[model samples]
Target: MATLDESERYRILSDERRRLVLEILAERTTGIGLDDLAQAVTTRQTTGTDVGPGTVDRVRIALHHKHLPMLDESGVLSYESEVRQVEQPRVASERHA
Candidate 1:
């Protein structure tokens, strides 16, 4: 279960879109990337909103400029983890003087 603080961090997202995205991610083991996630939200005709349209652009802009950096900074999700294809650089145990 997500803590209130964890959930609250996403208040930047409107409730409707956040719920929509969570629904999609809930159905999948691997998470969707931002572009695909936007398409999923917007294009789902069953939903009452046009989440498939500007939401994608908004999500991309937010992730590129805001949300992702904040999430990364908060240690919620690592930027390196999102880049699955790239081998994450190992942190050095010590720095030389």
Candidate 2:
């Protein structure tokens, strides 16, 4: 596995959705959910071109297969569940259910 540094981080941050991911993560002190991450990226105004909120296929699947694992592997983020995301909010919901 490759080690991550500021340069790699910046490289990852350059992509639109990936940049959004970094922005969202930077906004929070703790980790956010995978779905929340996708939602945060895609959600937009009524008239705007929403790139995601799209087939739900790209964001959801890419998030699971690529983004999440990349973040975790790069030591940028951490979580338990891959299928549903394991943020504090989701964990609470899981507990209450």
Q: Highest lDDT among the candidates is held by which one? A: 2
* C-alpha lDDT of candidate 2 relative to the true structure: 0.60
Model 2, 8-94: lDDT tens digits are 877676667666666676678776666777677665222275454464556766767776666666655554553565332233355
TM-score of 1: 0.45
lDDT string for model 1 (1-97, tens) is: 2234745666624456545554665576665566666566566634685454566676556544554454445433334335521111223442232
Q: Which window of 10 residues has the lowest lDDT sum in candidate 1?
A: 84-93
User: Model 2, stretches more than 4 Å misplaced?
Assistant: 1-3, 44-47, 50-54, 86-97
Model 1 CA deviation exceeding 4 Å by range = 5-14, 45-55, 62-97
TM-score, one value per model: 0.45, 0.60
- TM-score for candidate 2, residues paired by index: 0.60
